[model samples]
Target: MFLGSGSFISTTKAPSKEVAKPAVTAKRLMFLDSSITDSSVEVLQLPSPASLRKCALYAVFDGKVYWLRGIKPNINPVSLFVGNSIVNEDHFLATFKFDVIFIFTSLLFLKHDKFISVPQRIYELYRSGVVDSEECSVLESGMLALWNHNVDKVQDRLEYLCQKIKSDGSKDPLLKPNIDSFRAMLEHKVQSLEKAVQKSNLMMGSYCRASETSCHNHVRKNYIDFREGKLRLFCWSVISQMLNPEARSHLVPAKCDFNDISSHLQSTSSTAPLITSGNKGAKQRKITVAKGTPSILGFFKRT
Candidate 1:
């Protein structure tokens, strides 16, 4: 029969004289099946909160409960507590207390349709109660930005091909093959980039957002420490599309021998509008002065 949450089990068999007494206090608990053997009550001390923040979950289990730890992901076995008999049933019922159980439950509840069993080895760190909502939001946004960047790159390449087709008309026989090759390369690149972005998104989405410490903990647990260099790599990936030959010749490093082509293009493009506007303004001023000068000369002659 299935036991309700916090329900204790009492076997029909009476306690034997040889049976050991229960421990006065339980330092920790492990949630597993109710199989009480001499090795059932293994006491596992939890790590300090600061150290726990970096991990996923902390659990203390006997041999019976320890075996269940393998079924769940992100579970960290702490100190073991050994006792003669089970003390409290409610102690193990707190599913959120364990990182592996929490993650598995969240994934099962939130993403029930897509939930799949993950390896326990992967969840050995136990990172529950760490990540906050804001960090999750940031991670989601980062994933979206990466995905959008990939989409934009693909669209730009498609637009370039359209423009090329329009300009060439039916002239060059090699144009179609070149366009096809370019399209295939772009599709391949987009697929690879999308896969990377999706993996990050899944991790971010799986993160629980309850408190700042929790969020920070989750970030610390699931992700590598935030490095400026990693963010720079992301930025570079977004702008990498502009480097394609079809999008802009000058931006394409492969097409040009010089490394400073993009810088030159930026300098020239930025100055062109200013120079044109200045020339036009000067010509207008010259015309206005010329028109007034004739009147001034006539007045001088009359005087």
Candidate 2:
């Protein structure tokens, strides 16, 4: 009886204690894991009902999360999301990185989806004029279209107030001030639009000159490479020479051992794979052999 009891006690007690370890509760955090097939991108719904009406989703990418708003055209105002309704005048959503806040009522416009970087870049380029007139026009047109829609709403409110004053035949003390405020706002918007157009022109000039310089440099380098054949040096030397007069001598090739030269070329060739390592500071080097005859060596830095 004792031997039989001992065997049962050992099996039951150990198994029961092992199984009794607490189970971990997994929190509903958004995950952007590429390892799992379906975990590359995920949209998380917010908790608030008013905010839910807009159907905003938080997109998870790598470790960062971005908010994506759904926009319905001809039904929603683009300004509602990009402008003061959702984001503030400064376009900041909230104090924290992921905190999203809504600032209006009546779902006045449809939510719109856009890459956060795109509009911001366009705004900067427009303000800077680093793009062409055609490209700048398109950006300005889109911005104005959105701005007009928002301004139209404001104008409509002003007109309604004017009608209210006419119908009542009574001067409300605050009505005149409100009308003046709206008029000032309209003028401010017009000035902003003008500034955007002016900035675009400046940006275009800079962009064109930069593009021409790049093309000229590229052609010059190619000519040199074609002339040198297997003895062509790295393009970084040319760029460095352009940037600093002192670095000009560094561009010249010193007599290096044949094995060292071969090793350096191999190392440069291997550097291409490091570009996609998600490192901002990584450098990538490329050797383009024109007609597979080993002609040009280019080293590009990725920041």
Candidate 3:
């Protein structure tokens, strides 16, 4: 049942069989403020109201997220926020669309899907009270997370290949055999996830992320296992990190034989403009901008 705005609800770090303490106002649930209503009720706040949707969610477990306490964590663990748009009340949700759900007391970086199956886990924090409108966004968050997670693994492997690259050696470090060797586990997982996606576009879409937070709670239960979106476009790049050579660790040579080459590289990196490609098979274009003032010999300089 939906509590009216300003009515606060109370939650524990984990669902505990407490002796049914007096009910607390839902203020701390929807609104994050320094004002204390029920001293016992733990309040969770985002680093700032702007963290909504863009920042990782947290809960009572890591109460006062982004703030480091002692090894034990001094902040209370009952409140978690994916993002906060307000400090005092639902000025943001009541004003615009109410996007956050304040059911669970603790926050979690999605360990489960929208269903939230971990009875003992904090992902359960995000599992509660997800509405129909949010289904896709939730799915997208999970999809985005998993996609990034997969890409991170590839990028990590690519780190080893960095600086190891000599110009005479293979420029395409991500060759088939190399890609095959590193991406086996990722490929298998993607294929497994794809099979999980084949059942329905409802399964394949970006809308309504199927994050299941609890093993016990059954909300769109089937899709929770596979919170994937439009893999065809993302699989290649994510699985290979082929496009991001700069992310790898660089291996600078201890001795530089070519001073001119080093200077040329510095000039190119400093002067290069961003290049962008147009839609399907269009020529790439360079976006140039003047950095420092032109040298006095500018009149003869080639364009």
Candidate 4:
């Protein structure tokens, strides 16, 4: 069922630059019977090309040639001339002509993702029932946020959109499935944040305990070395007065009657052997020497 389709050669040239710009174009035709058909043809121009860039559209139906001539301007709109054959072929040929405006132009520079105005344009188109274009924007936005790990913003936007869709109540069935997928992605991000918090807490607790144990062990080792003569001190007398109460009382408290801390130390250390007094006429006495290091008593004084 061939109604009409045609091709035309467009030629352009600059007077100063002398650059030749040429492109081919196609036009679609619809018949009155509500059926669609395609009948494409390529038209070769003469050897002498024009100096100005031009695009043409030609359609042939029932042995008639329709000429629709158009020109290009810099960045604004351009005027065009349409022959009478196209106008007489179909009653709604004005609408058909509007649809073919982009067919004659260069579409190579058009990009869906890079265009800054594309989001707004797609939103407008979506309101006019062009939903597929809107879907592209949603997919692109979601992928970018996911790649950058912008969890909060993405989750908020997705939830808001999903709730809005739900409130609309089954108007567009195509969007229902997308809401479910968005919810799943939101849940995944929330769970990941929770796990991250738990891991951080566990690591902090382990570090604190390890640091405390290391400090205790360092202090204990230093005291043991000082008591065992393994480490020479800068001032052994000051340290001995701090640790040994008997030594402290002799040096710092001459009149105070202090308890003998060495006897307490001997009573605590099980490694020391006991010695009994040889005199039977006096009271029996037991004296012991500590085999290991004494406890830390630098802050205390014997009563």
lDDT of 1: 0.28
Question: For each candidate, what TM-score against the reference?
Answer: 0.16, 0.16, 0.19, 0.15
| Tens-digit per-residue lDDT, 1-303, candidate 3 | 111233322222333555543223323233222332332323222211222222222222111211111111122112223457322332221111111211111121122112221122223233444523233344334423322343234324433422222333433222111323333534564465465445654332221233323344443232333333324323322222211121111111213212233243334332212232223353544335355433212211111
* Candidate 1 residue-wise lDDT at 19: 51
RMSD of each: 29.5, 26.8, 23.5, 38.9
* Residue 63 in model 2: lDDT: 40
Q: Which stretches of candidate 4 lie over 4 Å from their true place?
A: 1-122, 125-173, 176-184, 196-214, 217-303
What is the descending TM-score order? Answer: 3, 2, 1, 4
- Give me the overall lDDT of model 4: 0.28
lDDT of 3 at 205: 23
Candidate 4: RMSD over Cα atoms? Answer: 38.9
The 0-to-1 C-alpha lDDT of every candidate, in the order given, reads 0.28, 0.28, 0.27, 0.28
| Candidate 3 whole-model C-alpha lDDT, 0 to 1 | 0.27
Report the C-alpha displacement of residue 137, candidate 2, in angstroms.
Answer: 43
Cα lDDT for residue 165, candidate 2: 27
Query: Which lDDT tens digits does candidate 1 get at residues 88-181?
Result: 4323322212212212222222222221222211132232334553333333332233223432343244334332233234321111213344
